[model samples]
Target chain A: MMWLFLVTDALLFAGFLGGYAFCRLASDKPWPDRTQVFDLTFITLMTFALITSSTTMASAVLAARNGRLQAARGFLLVTALIGLGFLGMQAVEWSHFIHAGARMDSNPWGVPGFSSYFFLITGFHGTHVLIGVVVLLLTTLRSLQRSNADELVEVVGLYWHFVDLVWVFVFGCYYLV
Target chain B: MSSQSGVSSYRTYWIGWLVLLILTVGMVFSGAKPVLVGGMLAKASIITLLYMHLMHERRRLVWTILLGIFLTSAVLVVLSVPDGMAM
Candidate 1:
């Protein structure tokens, strides 16, 4: 059921990307240069944090499955911390963009869709990260009290990894392309 | 997928992480659209297969998930891009 949900969620993102393509390709005005607007160094750091958290989550799952409850809980705690850090970095990015006069309807960039889609796509993904962090913390707390089900750890790991997967495309299409 | 001991499992995840990082760096350096798209796909595959353990699933389930999303997404992109360019 979890896998099925992920597939559907992924399809939803696929639609978003498709629409992003339409808006970008169809626009007469040039899309804003991402390099001018974004701090690539910070974005790269965000990516590193996410990917590392994913590895931690995976390790947590393995440790849980192997009956190392304490180790699993430790890994989960680290993953949650990293996830929170990623969200903090995203907040900084959003703050920088807003201070530069970007908004839902308009931005300093000539192409309105650029900022619109930027916020829409990244905002949606950021919300997922936030939710994942909350879930990880809750799970860690539960496991700290007593060992939780192994499947539960695996399922949460799946969601965390899926979030990372979506960011790969967002980073590629929005920032790199 | 064969059962990996705890050490090897952690090692596998880190290896996957390394590959993803390398791909990300390459994409950052290569601004070409094709290279970016290709790198993005590769990273997604690695996350799905290795980190998510999709490779451990039965063949039928794997095909269903991959094809369902991949084909539909491809169609959406293929149709959207050209029509958009023609606009």
Candidate 2:
């Protein structure tokens, strides 16, 4: 049951990536220099922040499984805080791009590939982040209600880890190569 | 017990994920195109394999379904991009 959701979620992302690549390949001109315009310094830090949050979320889930509700809540709160930080960084990146006057309509690098991909792919990912934030909030609420938190932690951890996995691919496809 | 079922029960994070992170950044600064491409493949494989690994351990039915789905997607990718893509 829990596992099914993750696979479905991954497939959804697969569709987004496929559509992104189709547009990129289907275009006539050269592909954009992803690394040059990406501002790796910002995304690198964002990756680190999100990865740290996953580690913390793992620990929180472990604590919950071991029957430590208070500790679980503490770690979950930290995970949420870190998630918020990543979201803030994402907002900053978008703001910088906006201020630089990049949009779906125009490609500054003269390659619509980058411009189109930048909006669609990251926009899909940002939506996932928002959903993740909401799930974490609900998990926190469940922490207060559940007498046994293991099942809740396990479910949330599955989603949290999936989010991390998604970013791992995104980081590769968008930033590195 | 056979060697393969035994293999499926064991679990660990690949150390390469940590190494790949540093390698990616280094490749960025080194001006080596091959390193960047190779590093990207290595890193993407790690994420894909790790996700598949976890899913296999958690739910066998979904594992089978996802495997079929992934394989089909791979075919589509090979037919499509400069390759079918992550879709």
| Candidate 1 C-alpha lDDT tens digits along A36-132 | 8898978988998998999999999898888888899999999999999999999999999999999888988888888889888999999999999
Q: Write the per-residue lDDT of candidate 2 for residues A77-112, one digit (tens) a residue.
A: 888888888889989988887676678878666766
TM-score of predicted structure 2: 0.79
Best by TM-score: 1
Q: For model 1, what is the error of residue B50's alpha carbon versus the real structure, in angstroms, after optimal superposition?
A: 0.4
Kindly report which residue stretches of model 1 are placed more than 4 angstroms away from their true locations once superposed. A143-148, B1-8
Model 2, backbone clash pairs (residues 3+ apart or across chains), number: 2
Predictions' DockQ, in order:
0.69, 0.22
- Over B1-87, each residue of candidate 2 has an lDDT whose tens digit, in order, gives 011111121123324336546755775676465876576556555544442334335366646755766785796577666543333
The superposed Cα distance between candidate 1 and the true structure at residue A127, in angstroms, equals 0.8
Candidate 2 deviant stretches above 4 angstroms:
B1-62, B82-87
Candidate lDDT scores, in order, read: 0.87, 0.66
Largest DockQ belongs to which candidate? 1
Clash number by candidate, in order: 0, 2
